[model samples]
Target chain A: DQQVKQNSPSLSVQEGRISILNCDYTNSMFDYFLWYKKYPAEGPTFLISISSIKDKNEDGRFTVFLNKSAKHLSLHIVPSQPGDSAVYFCAASALPNYGQNFVFGPGTRLSVLP
Target chain B: DVKVTQSSRYLVKRTGEKVFLECVQDMDHENMFWYRQDPGLGLRLIYFSYDVKMKEKGDIPEGYSVSREKKERFSLILESASTNQTSMYLCASIPGQGASGANVLTFGAGSRLTVL
Candidate 1:
C-alpha cells in the first residue's frame, strides 16, 4: 500500500504563472512534509518543508502548506520559471525517526512553457 | 561539488549475476540510505546505515543486502540479479544532528541498473 500519493502525474504552467502541486498521505502520524525536485539525470535536491505545528512555510517564491486534518500538503511556486520545471516529490516521515517512517510520493512532473 | 556520490551511473548485467552498487559521502554524516526509484512507485528504501557496521532494513529489503564497514561508504549487494530488479538506485544521507535537517536527504546522481 502507498502511504503517500501524488494524484497528479504531470502538470503544465506558463512561465510567470503560479504552479501548484498536491500530495496526500494515509498516515496521520506523519508530522513533517518535504518537497524535493529532481532533474533528468541529477539526484533530487531538497526544496522546502513544513512542520505539522505550522500550517504553512515559505521560502522565497516557494511555499508549502500542510493541512494536518486532511492529511494533505501542497507546494506552491509563484512566477513559475523554466528552471522550476522538474519532477517534484513529496516526502514525509514520522519524527524521532532514523529512516523507517519515511515515505515518498510517485512525484509530479511539472513543465513550464514560455 | 556533490556531497553524496554513487559510483556507477549505469550498469547492465545478466540474470543471476552478482551485482554491487557502491555509495560514498564526503559530508561525514552519520546516516546513509539506499533507495530504488520505479515508475509510479516512488522512492522505496532498501536499506539504511546509521553508523559504521550498523544497518537497518527499510520498506523493501528483499533481494538486497548492504555493507557499511566504514563511516564514508555503504555498499548494496544483489547476490543474484533478476529482471524485476531493474530500476534506478539512489544513495542518500541526512545530517542527523537536529530535527530541522534530519529528514532531509541529499541524494547522489542515481545509478540506473538493468538486469536481463
Candidate 2:
C-alpha cells in the first residue's frame, strides 16, 4: 500500500511563475514531512521540511504548507527558475521514531522553462 | 560539511553472483541507511543501522543484508544477485542526537548496479 502519494507525475511552468507540487498521505501517525530534490544520476538532496505543529514553513522563495485535516501538503516556489527543474519527493515520518523509517511518495518532476 | 561516500558509482554483475556496496560517512553520525531508487518507486529503504553492529530491515529487505562493523561505515550485500535487483542504491546518514522527528538526511552520489 502507498501511504504517501504524489499524483502528479510531471509539471511545467515558465520562469518567474509560481510552481506548486502537492502530496497526500494516508498514515495518520506521520507528523513530520520533508521535500527532497533530485537530479539525473544523482542522489536526492534535502530541500525543506515542516513539523506537524505548524501549518506553514518558508525559506526564501520556497514554502511548504501542511493541512492536517486534509492529510495533504504542498511545496510552493515563487518565481521559479530554470535551476529549480528537478524531481521533488515528499517524505513523511512519525514522531518518536525520528529517522527510523520514512515513507516517500512517487515524486513529481518539475520543469521550469526559461 | 557532512559527506557520505559510496565505494562505487557503477557496477555490473551476473545473476547469482555475490555483490557488495559500501558506504562511509565522515560526520560521525550514528544512523546510516540504504535505499534503492527505481522509476515510479521513489526511494525504498532496504536496511538501516543505528549504531555499530546494529541493523534493521526496512520496507524492502528481501535478497539484501547489511553490516555495520564501524559507526562510520555501513555495507549492503546481495547474497545472490538477480535481474530485478538492478537499481540505483543510495546511502544516507543522519545525526543521532539533537533532532526530533525526520531529520534531514544527507545522501551520497549513489551506486548504480546492473545485473545481467
Candidate 3:
C-alpha cells in the first residue's frame, strides 16, 4: 500500500510563473512532511518542509503548505526557473520513529520551460 | 557540508551472483539508510541503521540486507542478484536526534546496478 501519493506523474510550467506540485498521504500518524528536488544523475536534495503543527512553511522561492484535515500538502515555487526542472519527491515521517522510516511518494517530474 | 559517498557509481553482475553496495558518511550521523529508485516509483527504503551494530528493515526489504559494522559506513547486500534487482540505489544519512532528523536527509549520488 502506498501511504503517500503524488497523483500527477509530470507537470510543465513557463519560466517566471508559479509551479505547484501536490501530494497526499493516507496515514494520519505522519506529522512531518518534506519535499526534495532531484536532478538527473544526482541525489535528491532537501527543499522545504512543513510540520503538522503549522499549515505552511516558506524558504526563499519555495513554499510548502500542509492541510492536516485533508491529509494534503503542496509545494509552490515562485517565478520558476529553468533550473527548477527536475523530479520532485514528497516524503512524510512520523515523530518518535522519525529516522527509522520515511514514506516517499512516487514523485512528479517538473519541467520549467524557458 | 555533509558528504555521503557510495563506493561505486555503477556495477554489473550476473544472476545468482552476490553484490554489495557500500556507503560512507563523513558527518558522523548515527542514522543511515538505503533506498532504491526506479523511473516513476521514487525512493523506497530498503534498510536503515540508527547506530553501530544496529539495523532495521524498511518498507521494502525483500531480497535485500544491510549491515552497519561501523559508525560511518553502511552496506547493502544482494544475496543472489537477479535482473529485477537492476535499479538505482541511494544511500542517505541524517543526525540521530532533533527535528532536523526527519527534515534533512543527505544522499549519495547513487549507484546504478545492472543484474544480467
Candidate 4:
C-alpha cells in the first residue's frame, strides 16, 4: 500500500516564482512529516519538516503547511531559483517511539526555468 | 556534518553473480537502513539494523540479505544478482540519541548497480 502519495510526477515553474508541491497520506497515525530534496546521482537531503500539531512551519524561502483534517501537506518555495530544480520526496512516520516505521512518497520532480 | 558513506558509487555484475554493497556511518548511529530507488517507485526499504548484530527485513527483502556485525557498518548482499535487481541503492542512518522523538534520516550518496 502506498501510504504516502505525491500525485504529480513532475512540475515546472518560472524562476523567481512560487513553487508548490503537494503530498497526501493515508495513514492517520503519522504525526511527523518531512520533505527531502535530491539532485541527480546524489542522496536525498533534508529540506524542511512539520509536525501534525501545527498547521505551518516556515524557514526562510521554504514553508511546509500541514492540514490534519485533509491528511495532506504541502511545501512552498518562494522566489524559486534554478538551483531548486530537483526531485522532492515527502516522508511520514508515526514517531510513537525512537525507531518508528517511516514511509516515502513516489516523489515529484520540479524544474525551475531560468 | 553527519556522514553516511556507501563504499561504491557504481557497480556492474553479471546475472547469478553474488554482489555486496557496503555502508558506513561515522556518527555512531544506532539505526541504519538500506533502500532501493527506482523510477516511479521512489525509495523502498530493503532492510534495517537497529543495533549491532541485529537486523530486520524491511518492506522488500526478497533476493537480498544484510549484515551488521559492527555498529557503524552495514552491508547488503545479493546471493545471486538478477537483472531486475539493477537500481540505485541508498543507505541511511539515524542517531539513537532520540533527542526529541525525531526520526530524521541522514542518507549517503547512493550506489547505482547494473546487473547484466
Candidate 4 lDDT over residue span A1-114, tens digit each: 799999999999999999999999999999999999999999999999888889999999999999999999999999999999999999998876344387999999999999
lDDT score at residue A23, model 2, on the 0-100 scale? 99
Tens-digit per-residue lDDT, B1-116, candidate 2: 78999989999999999999999999888899999999898899999999999999998999999999999999999999999999999999998767532388889999999999
Each candidate's fnat, in order? Answer: 0.64, 0.58, 0.65, 0.58
Ten-residue stretch with the least lDDT total in model 3 chain B: B96-105
TM-score between predicted and true chain B, model 3: 0.96
lDDT to native, each model = 0.91, 0.93, 0.92, 0.93
Candidate number achieving the greatest DockQ relative to the actual structure: 1
lDDT of 3 at B32: 94
TM-score of chain A of 4: 0.96
For A37-112, candidate 1 gives per-residue lDDT tens digits of 9998788898998889999999999999999999999999998999998999999988876655679999999999
lDDT per residue as tens, model 3, A1-114: 789999999999999999999999999999999899999888899898888999999999999999999999999999899999999999998975545667899999999999
* Model 4 chain A: lowest-lDDT 10 consecutive positions: A93-102
Question: What lDDT tens digits, residue by residue, belong to model 1 across residues B1-116?
Answer: 33998999999999999999999999778899999998888999999999999999998899999999999999999999999999999999876757456767889999999999
* Every model's TM-score on chain B: 0.95, 0.96, 0.96, 0.96
Q: Worst ten-residue run, lDDT, model 2 chain A? A: A93-102
Docking class of 2: medium
Candidate 2: Cα lDDT at B48: 93
TM-score of 3: 0.96
* Complex DockQ per candidate: 0.71, 0.66, 0.66, 0.65
Q: Write the per-residue lDDT of candidate 4 for residues B18-106, one digit (tens) a residue.
A: 99999999988888999999989889999999899999999999999999999999999999999999999999988775453247888
